[model samples]
Target: MAKYEALGLIETFGLVFVLEAADAMCKAADVELIGYANVASGYISVLVQGDVGACKTAVEAGVAAVKAMEGGNLYSSIVIPRPHQDLGKIIKRYSITNLVTE
Candidate 1:
């Protein structure tokens, strides 16, 4: 979404599985691991960006990776193609750059 042609997200419980999913998604497709969010309830949402097809593939790979884990409990998965430009403004408020750096 935002400036990206497509955006994929996988939100699941547990940090380990979500991280693994993110890694697998990146390796499985031509996509970028943009960022991730962790909520107080131990839910982690991993975000990836690329073309529509790539984003779909990456999201499936990510969800599958999480499903392969014994305790993985995937909550939601989404793929947004050609999201509105204004979405970037909201996403920037999250400071995804800082998340990647540290």
Candidate 2:
């Protein structure tokens, strides 16, 4: 099983806001940034992994950060506790390790 107990996602309207949200998420809890996905048309989703509680706190912080940003518009956010193992197949592609090596 993966070490992470939960998966958190924060979607925003623009790159800048998503970046800010990512920063806030990492800083607010013991979570690891799992890189981000650009969903096109200025929409982006930042992912994070950690324990259930940490993921919850991180998502909250991320949403708040985006809301506080001048031009930020949050699309949505979620914390999935104990995600299905099958979900890992898709998440691996967006892992930070891939971002660092590529």
Candidate 3:
């Protein structure tokens, strides 16, 4: 079994909105913040990992938090359960493991 059963992502336009989402996600579920990525043009993607149900709940909470922001601009959001191990290669730089070791 994988260490984490699911991965959640939330993309938004404002840093403050994303931070709000991240805070909500962590508080609403037993998830780990894997880190975030800036995709330029004021877009950022926040990542979290946990069990399937927790990931889904966390993503929902994050989306709601962003929507609650006065001028929040949410780009997209997703929850991937049982993702392929190889997917890590693509997002390795944003993983918490990378942050810890570096």
Candidate 4:
């Protein structure tokens, strides 16, 4: 399966509330959430990994779903990162592991 990396910017209703919803949406999409960073203003940046088609579809679906919610706003950009290299290495490096399981 081909791997894809995506960067999503979510403008949430509220930090905590929307973050919870984002988490749920990511889980439902089967996205391998690599890492996230809170921007200076009020944007949450996310990095995720998945199959090319699945990731694109999921990202669009997730954004639409969020927009449908009572108070949610989100946008995303899918990036290949490099000319001919996959972003798997970066994804793996930033992936959150379950310490107990590890």
What do the candidate models score in CA lDDT, each in turn? 0.84, 0.91, 0.91, 0.51
42-97 per-residue lDDT for model 2 (tens digits): 89999999999999999999999999888779999999999999998888888778
Model 1 Cα displacement at 90 (Å)?
A: 2.8
lDDT of 3 by residue, 35-80 (tens): 8988899999999999999999999999999998888889999999
TM-score of each: 0.88, 0.93, 0.91, 0.56
RMSD to the true structure for each prediction, in A, is 1.9, 1.3, 1.8, 4.6
Candidate 2 regions off by >4 Å? Answer: none
- Write candidate 4's Cα lDDT for 39-75 as tens digits: 5476655555565554555556556666666666554
| Runs in model 4 lying further than 4 Å from the true structure | 1-21, 24-28, 79-102
Q: How does residue 75 of candidate 1 score in lDDT? A: 92
Range of the 10 consecutive residues with the lowest summed lDDT in candidate 2: 93-102
Compared with the true structure, what per-residue lDDT tens digits does model 1 show for residues 1-102?
A: 445798888998888988888898999899988788886589888888889999999999888988988887999999999878887665555446866664
Q: List the residue pairs that clash in candidate 3.
A: none
